[model samples]
Target: MTQHDTDHALKTGGEQGYLRIATEEAFATREQIDVYLRMVRDGTADRGMTSLWGFYAQSPSERAMQIIERLLDLGERRIADMDATGIDKAILALTSPGVQPFSDTHEAQRIARSANDLLAERCAAHPDRFIGMTAVAPQDPQWSAEEIRRGAHDLGFKGVQINSHTQGRYLDEPFFDPIFRALSDTGQPLYIHPGTPPDAMIGPLLDAGLDGAIYGFGVETGMHLLRLITIGIFDRYPDLQIMVGHMGEALPYWLYRLDYMHQAGIRSARYERMKPLKKTIADYFRSNVLVTCSGMAWEPAIRFAQQVMGEDRVMYAMDYPYQYEAHEVRALDAMELTPEVKRQFFQTNAERWFKL
Candidate 1:
């Protein structure tokens, strides 16, 4: 067998099987680090921002410079981690709250551009093992559209990755139409990852130590996605595709309930002036939205996602560097799926969505 075939065979339990492609992998540029540090030094960073960085870093008491070092080392350390974990390719994106933390549009755009350039360079150097997703700050919708075009058309990024909201603004707002239209025009999928909640919005959750992935990530992202659905984003841009990680942020489990509530709310004229969507919320979930098994390694969640979203819409991800558990591959392998389903989950589905 060819080397490629042999590797696939080793990964997929045969001699010429599936190649694993993790779509929700993350990285950070040194420039991004510098900007974040500047924010911290200037006292402009969000309440939990510095502490969040420290949580991921090696040092518990201060900014995890070591973790920042690892994020910047997209070359050796990251690739080594992937290799050890049986991941043949990783679709890399900027880490959470990437350029979104920047309140200045100009600064956000500059930082996003620099980060995208860095990601593109890394992917070019390791095309077989890496693919890049473009990063854009939504502070300027027009600029974000242009950057999405540039990143996908010129830099060859696989798609776009946006943290759930820009500052406190979510994607459901009409102000983001240009951004959605741009994504539609490029035919690149957009991955909506989570960011820490605005302090004012989730103060209690933050104090309860659920600010990050444990509970808050899903709560925030799940709400962001529901907002997209209720506010008619999918209705307006039918061609635009979006992805949410962490097993659809608990959406699949509540699919029927969401549909029921959506109907009930609209029928009640809850927001009398707001227009209702043409289709059920679950229709959009199956049609325009895709979900990944990022950071969530539980078997039941993955299986439930498949049940609701269908195997074709479900793909594998490790949520690398953050939830980079080595046993995840084994967990996926142990799933009660046929080889064909496994191939779709690990390879073909991502290839189809990200144009891999």
Candidate 2:
């Protein structure tokens, strides 16, 4: 990594860790479309889930295009701003909602491939300064594996960031088994970010949307991670590396409760293969899971993660575009830890996690 902007003086250029100006959830133009427009299935269907509609608003075609163009420029400007803020690299993905917006299995795969290709090109042009994570449609098991391989081999990406669930199907669904196998085989780090309409978004809660993401993204994602842990996905695929944004989807805070529940025997048979769900979760976090300081980079949270997962597993990141660089940079710049820990969060951990 190169030295950051000299004007903002601090001890930079150290090799302890790396920084990622992340915009993981902002790439998919379609992910923002309301579910009313892309109605994939009836509510009773297997993957029966309603999509969030209020992600963005209506606009004329030409005006929408112009707005998009401006957003792209703003994204680039954010990168420059990140550079000035002392971020060494920007680990960009095709935003969130991602390919799940496409209901047709074939179409989803196609759009995902295209998005990965475009992101790959971006990384190619600025290999030193930018890195990419592949996008894949997890609607089907077979196609998901293929897309992940293509992203890694063809696009030169380090890992992937994905929504908590597709439609209504959670991560532990059988639909993702083949995909999980390939990920374990290739050792691709799968990032699981959160995006689910709140309880109010469906049925009576239709208007209760946007409410979820404000504080609900973390809760929803935490629920998903809890399910995965209880279901023992990590036990089945011990090598699978999963990355959760928003500080491990509130895992650290909820871990003790999970442990107590297990001790209280709430879900006895659920965690059959693991030593303990809490231990398994923490071990996975320490061994296979990576966490990003996307929107929740509190000093206590970051420090807690450092002690639990060690400084090597936490990476400094701005949720960028959707989350400005300042939020992330300021978090790192203001972190009250040893210089070594600060360096690790800012640079070294991400360097190893993303291979940047």
Which candidate has the top score in lDDT? Answer: 1
Q: Give a tens-digit lDDT track for model 1, residues 1-356.
A: 23333233224223336888899988987677777777777888776565565355435543355456667778988877777777899999999888898878788888889889888888899988999998998888899999999998899998999998777888877888898988989999989999888766768877888888888878988999888888888778888788999899999999999999788888888786346787888889889999999988787888888888788999999887777777667767666678899889989999999987
lDDT of 2 by residue, 134-173 (tens): 7778887788888888877777888877777777677787
lDDT of 2: 0.64
Task: Show model 1 residue runs off by greater than 4 Å.
Answer: 1-16, 57-66, 272-274
Segments in model 2 whose C-alpha atoms lie over 4 Å from true places: 1-25, 29-78, 198-210, 266-279, 325-328
Angstrom error at residue 304, model 1: 1.2
Q: Relative to the unseen true structure, what is the C-alpha lDDT of residue 76 in candidate 2, on a scale of 0 to 100?
A: 63
Pairs in clash, predicted candidate 1? none
Q: What number of clashing residue pairs does each candidate have, in the order they appear? A: 0, 13
